[model samples]
Target: MKKHQPAYLKSHSDGTLAKKLAAANARLQHCDLCPRRCLVNRQAGEKGFCGAGADLKISSYNAHFGEEPPISGTHGSGTIFFTGCNLRCVFCQNYPISQLGHGQPFTVRELADIMLELKKRKCHNLNLVTGAIYLPQILSALELAIKEGFDLPLVYNCSGYESLDALELLDGIVDIYLPDAKYNDPRMSKKYSQSADYPEINKLALKEMYRQVGDLILDEEGLAVRGLIIRHLVLPENIAGSEQVLEFIAKEISAQTFLSLMAQYHPAHLASNFPELSRRLTKPEYERVVDKLHELELDNGWCQEL
Candidate 1:
């Protein structure tokens, strides 16, 4: 069987990657990278809602084995956890990294070196976690990494609140999109994540991701190469609106779409402040969402046991 060549290699070869880098870099001056549309000029050291500046800030980078099977595989996914986030999720597990920004800054060249190092470590894919704010920097680093013969499949792991413009720049570059369909109810989204438009934006982002990658395609080794994987974490007391999220995926996106129905919703960060979100997901709550998944015939995914 022929080896799977990543989409970015072709994009790099055709010079489109350079164009994308240029386009993405231009947005840093008036930053509209995510749905927040915080027009702060990151180039001038202005911080926006995400709290990211000009430099690329990363909390850590390592071969992570905790992702979905295809993503982690036997070798593990090379995960780069970027600092800061557009959405301020009250129950964020990594609030110290995302909200408080506990990370070191790196230039584009250094970031490129990290990507090469991950490739050298024999990672299955380069998993970029919550890097929507650093789109330009990522593109710049990817361009450099490609020059150094880095060719691992790029996994864009992100919250589903994305901008079409930013996603368009990554059209032929990102091989796999791992985005979360966090909430289906605007009120729930607003109260929990501080993003009232999360549901509307998340739906559009999922459609765009599906349009780009179609469905998950695995190799002979059962490892994902190019695809869209939607993760829906079942929040306490149906706060995540899991049923409606499944319905949207089944009806709007293909029923064959790959999903990661997560059940590990433990209260963290500011979750204690909200009574509804102050506890771990009950088994009944999780099973109800699982029932909905089965009823919708969305069988091409993984479900966690509560």
Candidate 2:
């Protein structure tokens, strides 16, 4: 079997990647990168709702094996955890990195070097976590990496509250999109993540991602080459609206859509502030969502054991 060349390589060779990089950089002036539309001029050192500026701040990078099998493979995924996030989820597991912004800033060239280093370590793909805020910098780093023979598949690991414009810039550049379908209820979204428009925005983002990459495709070695993988964490008390999310994926997206039904929702961060979110996800709650997964015939991915 032929080794799968990532889509960004073609985009780079054909000049599409450069165009995207430039377009993404242009957004920094007004900064509508995510759904927040915080018109702050990040290039001029202003911080927005996500607390990110022009500088690229990264919490960590490593070969991670804890992701979905296709993404991690045997060598593990090259994971780059970016600091800060668009959504203020009260139960965010990585609050130190996402909320408190615990990370070191790096120049674009250094960021590119990190990608090269990850490839040298033989990771399956470059998995960028919470990167929507730093899209421009990531694109810049990717351009530099591509020139230096870095060809790992790019994974846009993100919260589903994405802007269509930002995703448009990434159309050809990102090979795999790993987005979370956090909630189907606006009330739940608002109460938990502090984003009232999350459900509506998330659905649109999922649809756009599906349109860009129809279904998950694995290589001969069973590693993902390209696709859209939607993850839904079964929150306690059905606050995540897991059943409705599954139905939408099966009906609106595709029955063939790959899913990661996450059953690891342990209350963290400020989850204790909300009585409904203070406990871990129960076995029954997770099993109910698993049953819905089977009932909807959306059986193309993994479900963790509760």
Candidate 1 residue 61 C-alpha distance from true site, Å: 0.3
Q: Which residue pairs collide, candidate 2?
A: none
Q: Candidate 1 lDDT (Cα, whole model)? A: 0.94
List residue ranges in candidate 1 displaced over 4 A.
Answer: none
Model 2, residue 10: distance off in Å is 1.4
Q: What does candidate 1's lDDT look like per residue over 121-209, in tens digits? A: 99999999998999999999998998899999999999999998889998999999999999989998998889999999999999999
* Candidates in order: C-alpha RMSD to true structure: 0.7, 0.8
By summed lDDT, the worst window of 10 consecutive residues in model 1 runs over 276-285
- Backbone clash count for every predicted candidate, in the order shown: 0, 0
What lDDT score is found at residue 122 in candidate 1?
Answer: 98
